[model samples]
Target: MKRINRLYIKSIFSALVISLLSCSDDFLTKEPKGVVVADLLNTPKGVDNLLIGAYSLLDGAGSSNGFPSYAYPASIRNWVWDCASDDAYKGTTLGDFATGGEVERYEALPTNQLIEQKWYVMYDGVSRANDVLKALAKAKVNMSEANVNVLSAQARFLRGFFHFRLQQMHFQIPYITEDVADPALVKNDHPVWDEVETDLQFAIDNLPESFPGEPGRATKWAAMAAKAHVHLFQKEFPAAKILLDAIIASGKFALVDNFRDNYTASTENNKESVFEIQSAVNDGTSQGFNGNPDSWTTNPYNRFLPTCCGMYQPSQDLVNAFKVDKDGLPLLGIGGPKYNDTNLKNDMGINSADNFVPDTHLLDPRLDWTVGRRGIPYLDWGINTGNEWVRDQVNGGPYIPIKQMFTKAAQKDASHTTFARATAINYRLYRYAHILLWRAECAIEENDLPKAMQLINQVRKRASDDFVMGKVNTYAFPSSVTIDVDYTKPAANYLLGEYKTFPSQAYAREALQMELRLETAMEGNRFFDLVRWEKDAEVLTKFVENDSKFRVFMKGAQYKKGVNDHWPIPQSQIDIQKGVLIQDPAF
Candidate 1:
């Protein structure tokens, strides 16, 4: 339970592998280096170090195969998920990350390298987790049986976590475990939910409720939360509710007073964090071809910022989704007066340097926190000058991502300088707010409208605290003009209110769905949530139809009902297994 330095652990891992290489024979032609490393991993310290390596993969980088060309597939941020949904556009030009553009347009094929690379990185995580189990079983260490159980449980949890991510992307993926001696012979013909659930259950039963010293390591609460997430996706409401209720009663977590704190580095591993990926910089490691030699660094700053490639632009629809009524409730759908109407206002056609006014109308405070629109404070960075921050406003729109970008003051301590931008910001995988919303969904499915409304209101009330504005420090443009103002002032007519009641089950469900979209926005769960609720077709079809009007890139995008629900099994993977892996139906 000690605060284990990830950099120190990685150093040990590197040194051990380096020590195994002799001057005589090439280690590549002989037994795999992992086999040699596993032989030395017989002591308790060695087993724990191996477990650390498994944890390192949480960043979705650091593979021995070298970094993936684009950070989308490898980074835990999963920008592709946001792009695939209505929440965001594949920013930049058409030719940049062309395969990703195909995904955004719903034209993805089995041969898309983006999909294939994602499959490779996730499977590599599975293989690494399995390696820990293989080594643990063979170890001759004189550790207590309880200690071994905990280690084995941690390894199984990681294996399940990696497989679960694959399952979300490719529903019928192969669930590789320690039993599988050869992964190439495995088949992706069956649903891995059963295996994933089983592994998570073991982890839930074995992991400690809290690890005070090691904040980022998975705990019993995290395992339970992850298992419940799987159940929610599978529509097992009763099952999910039980775990969620326990987490809520455990008093282990609570939403931070300021929602923006969840995204900042200075306040990481706060009370709201249930499980977060650990990232560190300036740890004395040299920056590699991509960024830091350590694959844990995030590259969103490279692409999402306007000063850079300006990829992952927030969609106009998403910006409009934040519009609230006079009473602070969301004006839902395109039928609403404010919906998709220019009255809501944006920088779509305006130049950044030209003097223009931002739409200071009724809006959700979270909108400014989530999207860096023109004229608003962008977390200690200068006021977002629309076109100046945008690479090509004509193609990508005029908004840049804000949640993951580091503040200028914290950049030295939080990010790495490279050919592209990279940062040490930890990607929050599970948080208490997500738990609240998932529980609310379960309540709605169980016909507990009052309970659902109450839970939903709790989330809203926290968001409506109105203290977030004070937490943000505004900066002047041109590095000269010193115009001081109250940070508490509404950025853009910010108005968000709690739900009073729900007249019908349908109404409650609709409100719950919209709340999730508004709350999470661009954190990469929109597409998956829609799929889980079986509302992908209804939601995305309308989103594409409406969004295409403004975003020319989405002109031909279509969300096929059943086929698009799950991505196709990579053609190369099926070919590698020689038909052992069956493609999803209709692929």
Candidate 2:
């Protein structure tokens, strides 16, 4: 409702490339980049771009001028804010995001720019989705029942998602429907999950399982997944179990064979993808707005993108999470809070050209796929030498995030060289593994430890089969981790084994929770998951201290319970809404 674009900023909505061309020469061709056409509101193309515009903001980048780096606070990836947990650092320069210690620590305030940016993006997405619905209502004259159902369903699904994202961040939020006369007047009075659920249910009732040619479009199963994901946050185990069971029963999704497949652009919309926010490049626009502009700052600094600013480096605590026992089971088994006590060897102050050996600790194979440790192969981008790929090893740490990056070969079409962190990579919002783990949570609650073990094992089985490997031409690890010159061997001392039994409900819960962390680590789910499980205060308080030992910038950081669970409503929005909106309690 309080749009940054309509006021200080120009256009927050993405530029829908609408072409109105005659069969004549270049004079007849008029391609409007940012403005929505008033005349084409009833035409099919206008409605289509409005729909696409709703989908576009999922990446948190927009405008016809140029690409906004995905590292910004609004990115669906949640890299900056989610770092408030233990998974990663704000990285790059210490004062980066220019937030000081706001996000990385719990020093954030109502006036933080990141908070305002993220709030507006979510609301912008809601506004765009409403636009599609209102336009469709007026234009339904030329549409069939089936077409309208699918199109309207998609808009509702997006509207549900944008509000759901808002709910995840704040304690109170307003759910704006198309019927609302003035969204600014809408009160953040009661909980919006019921409204969110209704929208998603409509999507499930009308959406198809697949869109035939459109892989990015939301399907019925994807809608179910979205609702089930919210159910987890609400701790609605029975309701969540029902939805997840129906999805698995549908047999519509499964994990991709290789763990690496989930990260690369080539394997997007694979078997595991439940719902992916689509991005593209090189479709004739001067700027690649359709690509992942959000990724610009989360990668290794400058080695790939010449102007790359990302250093969303993995934490030493997160690295220690991969520690496995002799049998390859996690060493931090069954809620040992000291899981991060022993860190794998790192190259903190070491130079790039210096000799550094890869850590020989027995680790889950997913670690290599998730993190870019010193001596490991970072996808197809060659062996990661400490400090070379990172901007400041002292502040950002010795590792970079690998899961959010692309394989070297995938970068050709996946990226455009012009300010090219805008990758064509599809952001996997929900994967099949997520449903399995969500169900595992239900199984744990029911004291069905065996069922939980079985579900958790299904995910680990996939991890053990896939290990990161250096490319044929890349440098090899120090023989301790590799056997051949082509780097045919697994990159790290990778070992992922299945659990035989859960032993008890407590152990099963801890194991299941840890599995979720190992699986989704650097993808920006850590902080919220900690909060969802009510472990944010304990984990994050200790996290800042533990993380502070290495990342000096977080030395005095703290996470206060009740207060830090949700970010404060941005002061800007509250003022704009007058008395209609109130800030979250205590901050």
Candidate 3:
């Protein structure tokens, strides 16, 4: 959405690199070199630069070492969250990312290195945000009180955002601020929801409706939307509804005409994007893996690219959840017959060389947009070739991720090839469609079935209208074969329609839940949604049971309620902090 200034971004990167190179216990505490560095930070220019540094952490890249690793816990893509949920599988071949496999199988221990890495990265973000506020507090340059307030508001917003992420993953976390002189002394034992709300509210009050030159920066609407999301997760329906209604009345956002556009680089930061993590490629940084100072790159291409490691495959249960009846409605009956028995076409047990066709039965139009199935044109990368494209189909199944990838046409400007496929595809943390579904959930919980149904149908209508594929001239295979296919043809027996009315509140509740799962299938929200609904055990237990039948790797998987509700506080963190952080139950 915003063409981030290369010079400005590079300056921020340079500062971060210098701080990292010093090898201090805390990078934020690094002393400024001289008048140039100190004067720059004390003036208005310094405040802006510091703000950019705080924003840079949104990508979850906390190092200047350049190598893209899954160890970065704060990755906006939510790879770990997706794998832990029933919507996806740890698609990489066995013996690769074994720690990730443990997470996938519900066997993660405090010793899991990935968990520790993530804990550090998220706190790193919190620390950066606090540094911005601390810098502003002691600035020697002349600045208006209003300007200072705005900067503080933005910094606090980020602080709250990072803390909220920790709470979501770990359930209990210490809320750090600029006032904290020594973070090591903080305890991860208390709830920080009140502090989070205060920070977000400050942002909502101070942020402008839009930043003209900085499109991806947080805005008033972003703050409100994020706070609303927090309330929804906390089951504060009425409180969340007030914020959602205000957002709708603001008239600053709406769903784009095409659902696929929300995922592609060609149409990022459109009308629907509420808050997006900005990424950049080939930005004149020679640092290679570590040198790109702006934290504006991602490794989804490397992981999701069929030819690469092929991690994060969509699950068959997720695919089957997309099935619709003749009337274009989800086949509804919770705790009833599993939908996988409906003869839905799948590529399990079938090889890439085998003659197979995608299920042509009536289905939701959003399925093709959310998943890369066999025989479907996977953007410009050609038809998905089953096992050939998958790293291990028997373990992870056939589907590859689609929503987070960039197209070949857009890759020139949006992607870079280092050790992995790093691209500038912004990870959308909040979008209009997400807001609609969340508001629907609020309404449903409040017993406002009529209002909930209307909101749900609004989202469904958008998916139905945005189902058409883009124009493609020719499809090429990785093995040097090319073929022509009608780009306008539907990839499956696609059919979807708006509900005339909800049969009852129970039916409406089920429909609303299904809508959330389908609308935000693999963007890392599923497991959390299950937890929020208090249905994690029921849904995931059924998911493991049904999916394990075909996906052998998941045979022993189980979801123990209360225990699996939150990941154990990383054991490494506990030992390092000398028991400042207590482990959650059933660890």
> Best by lDDT, which number?
2
Candidate with the larger lDDT of 2 and 3 = 2
- Per-residue lDDT tens digits for candidate 1, residues 1-587, read 11333443346664454233211111011124565565677567777766776666666565544454534665566777668887887777767778878878888999998788778767666765675676677673577777878888888899898889889988698878777766666777788888999999999989987776688788998899999999988889999999999999999799898888888778888999888877665554454222322223211233224234566778888888888888788876433564555536776777644456556577888888888877776777655656666767766777777777778788776666542255566667899988999999999988999999989988888888543343223332333445444666655577789878787788888888889988887778888888998988988898889878878888988999998877888888777677578888778
TM-score of each: 0.90, 0.89, 0.90
The alpha-carbon lDDT assigned to residue 160 of candidate 1 equals: 96
Lowest lDDT sum, 10 consecutive residues, model 1, at 22-31
lDDT of candidate 2 at residue 347, scale 0 to 100: 80
What tens-digit string does per-residue lDDT give for candidate 3 at 285-325?
54322222222222222333523456777888888888887
Q: Which residue pairs show collisions in model 2?
A: 70-293, 70-294, 297-310
> Which window of 10 residues has the lowest lDDT sum in candidate 2?
21-30
Each model's lDDT: 0.72, 0.75, 0.72
Residue 225 error for model 2, in Å?
A: 0.4
| Best candidate (score: TM-score) | 3
For model 1, state the Cα shift of residue 8 in Å. Answer: 6.9
Taking the tens digit of each residue's C-alpha lDDT, what string does model 2 give over 1-587? 01211111223322422122110121111223334464466556567667776766677775222236322777878877777878888788865665735777788899987787777677767777777787788788889988888989999999999899989999889888888876667888877999999999999999998987677778999999999989999899999999999999988899888887887778887889988877766654445555666666676785543436755678888989889888788865445534677667888887765566656778898888888776666766766656777887767787777776776676777776675666677778899999999999999998988899999999999989687765322233342543233477766677889999788887887888899999999888998999999988888887777776767777777778898888988888887777888878687
